[model samples]
Target: MGLKAFIGKLYAGIAQKQIENMRKNGIGLQNKTFQYLVNEATATVFGIDHGFANIKTYEDFKARVPIRDYEELRPYIDRIMRGDDDVLWPGQPAYLAKTSGTTSGVKYIPISKQSMPEHITAARNALLNYAYETGNTSALDGKMIFLQGSPEMHEVSNIPVGRLSGIVAHHVPIYLQGNRMPTYKTNCIEDWEEKVEAIVDETIKQDMRLISGIPPWCQMYFDRLSAKTGGKKIKDIFPNFKLFVYGGVNYEPYRARIEESIGFAIDTIETYPASEGFIAFQNSQKDKSLLLLVDAGMFYEFIPAEEFFNDKPTRISLKDVELNKNYALILNTSAGLWGYNLGDTIKFVSKNPYKILVTGRIKHYISAFGEHVIGEEVEHALMKIAAEEGLDVVEFTVAPQVNAPAGQLPYHEWFIEFGKAPADLKAFSQKVDKVLQIKNIYYADLIEGNILQPLIVKVLKKNAFVDYMRAEGKLGGQNKVPRLSNDRKIADQLTEYILN
Candidate 1:
């Protein structure tokens, strides 16, 4: 009937067969899925061997195809670098999904009409799976605001071209096609700016609830709804609104701010949103990975952080992925990708098949001398400081730069933007540094060698991340700011323009 019913039925149908496949193969369920995917991946690239065809058999793929990062995807990047339809796989790449990654300067990801369904299905199934778990399927009543990239519609064709928003723009035509979607689909127009504005307008009028997108965009949507309707809080704008779904970026300060702004402790759900795929999600209970969409789309991989990019990356099969272990996330998607390292570190919050926590980005790590620093480490450090300082951090970024003098270990430099800064800010910084140093003996050794020093706090002014993003045009409506930077190039530029 609805999206959920259709997906639920689909999920149920495959689940039983999946169990049987696992039993027959004498392998774990997760591996069974991956094995099946290997079969498909080998098929997708079986005969072809160029940007037009990178497909090789599973064994050949394993031997010939090295695991590639965003930078390694350069050839494919170059093919569609110009957004030439001819370069993409035998179809129109609905829009080029833009993301500012580690190495490759501003690159556009080719998201096709076919790829769109996988993303949509994985995301939709995640929500329904959550609903089944929480017994709150009806909680989706009222308006559901999506805080995605602004629909940057092409003026001539009346479609969208915004890099990040392309993720949704392609779907607009399909969902809104005559009888395919509910009447609500027509609420979206053919204008870039109006896409977000129209969604806002509907929530105010239709009592919207269930907002989804990155944390920053959600806050913007609320700000727009509040400023326009004279209602400062999300509840004030949509009184019937019940749930707020967030992902794409971490939700620390926004969580506190939104909770305070909303009259009641509103429903807040977090998800793992990526351009290549929607990999994992969190539900209302916040018990970590809710339910993984194992059947519908992609085959995943997990390599240990210690060896993710090494000559021989230490890896564990999905079947071997344990609960609460940080592993580099890799995937082979139905959209024609094999052994793709998505460049994010995730932990198995559960092992009942498909579920994980988005710990941090694989590339965004701070190795204080030797103790490898990951996003989770920084998140822990900041959350601890926030709790101690009684501050609600809206957004923050960390940069492990060559900030120290020529020979000293580089400092764990943090640029913090908080809802409240304490009088004893120095104490806060000291505490954070102390925690990190103790947590990793590498920090202690580095401190002994003056290789690593204490955590330095750069208290940013308001809307610091936003200003930095704006300076970089990273704020073009539906984009996000990097949560962590290894160098001061992007980070300092952002801090100078915004936080300074």
Candidate 2:
């Protein structure tokens, strides 16, 4: 066998062992995992203060610790930043994964030394499981390129800070360094445009067998590659490319553009990693859902999305979650976050092996008129419309047009920047409205009751969304266009940028 094939077989074996262990334990292992976390964390300040030593059951643990978001944990993180050990976990985190915030400027999530191995292992298993399940391991033959944030780490109160992607890149196995592209020097360039140019120069001619990145940025890279090489598609440049691993945002809308650029069908794997920790990843080529990383150094809980904003919410363990219900994910990780709300919504597609689909962000939606619409629903509707109309959507956002001058009703406004505009723009807008109406009963009722006008569609000037993100300081690397907003905050901003 070739070296790549040998490596693929090795990875398959490792992933199989992990999968078998989970299958052997089943739901019973969740309780054991929770117990193990509690025991390991009992010595920390959070654990002691939360009465972790006395907790014996999931119910007991839930009753002691309340569900919290980053704001609630900021004080503890601040203490950790000041060089305090055992504030949240056993010792200080190896680094803080700095993430862009919606309203807040930034968020610093701790990445503990105790938890780094778990993070690394979860990533490895994702690739290996895909190889084993599909028997398509040629991806291991050549270099795998990842488009990530700059690796230049900054310091916050004497603690290192950088993007999660950069932190993970630092931990890439030594054996695989020869097979990963874009040298560390190139990865450290702070300017995104410069870095993209550098990456194109560094890997354009390499045997790039695998490519992984968020879909929108990946689209940007493909565009640059095609432009520089004078190629019709990415396949013309890198014929050996086999897999496209993506996450952080919905890929449905970008799928057509990416495939067209590739000039052929290639396998795709979706992952659900966040600043808090890696959560889940695609484990089978046949399945659309992701298997939860149950064995990783994290304990999971779910709060029904409906009750999430209530005065008091219900938290359900993995065994209690029902299929098809939207739930806000809660995590108590080895990295020291406990009962933390990651703010993303998810729905389970399978319960046997516990596979889930990310629905949307809990804070991202349009609910100004009691006609609630989440990101997932919006993306799905747009994807359907684009497919039928042969359009290529580059980026888009939706907001409630709440303030009408006079003699008009409120409605939802869609701002879209298309790579390929439709032949009949009016018909495309009508189809988009129709699909959304079918998907959301609340929205349909609002239209039926004459409480909302037919949705307004605004075909944005080219690069409008990109310009907006650039002005907002969130131009690249896991930052995404806010899919749905309750108010016209983002829509107004995009309007201003387009005018400029």
Candidate number with greatest TM-score: 2
Give residue 103's error in model 1 in angstroms: 2.0
Which residue runs of candidate 1 sit more than 4 Å off their true CA positions?
1-60, 76-98, 108-114, 138-141, 152-202, 227-231, 283-286, 401-410, 476-478, 494-500
lDDT of candidate 2 over 441-464, digit per residue (tens):
999999889999878778888878
Clashes of each: 12, 0
Which 10-residue span in candidate 1 carries the lowest summed lDDT? 173-182
What TM-score fits each model?
0.79, 0.96
What's the residue-level lDDT of 98 in candidate 1?
67
RMSD of 1: 5.3
Model 2 lDDT, residue 293, Cα: 78
Per lDDT, the best of the predicted structures is 2
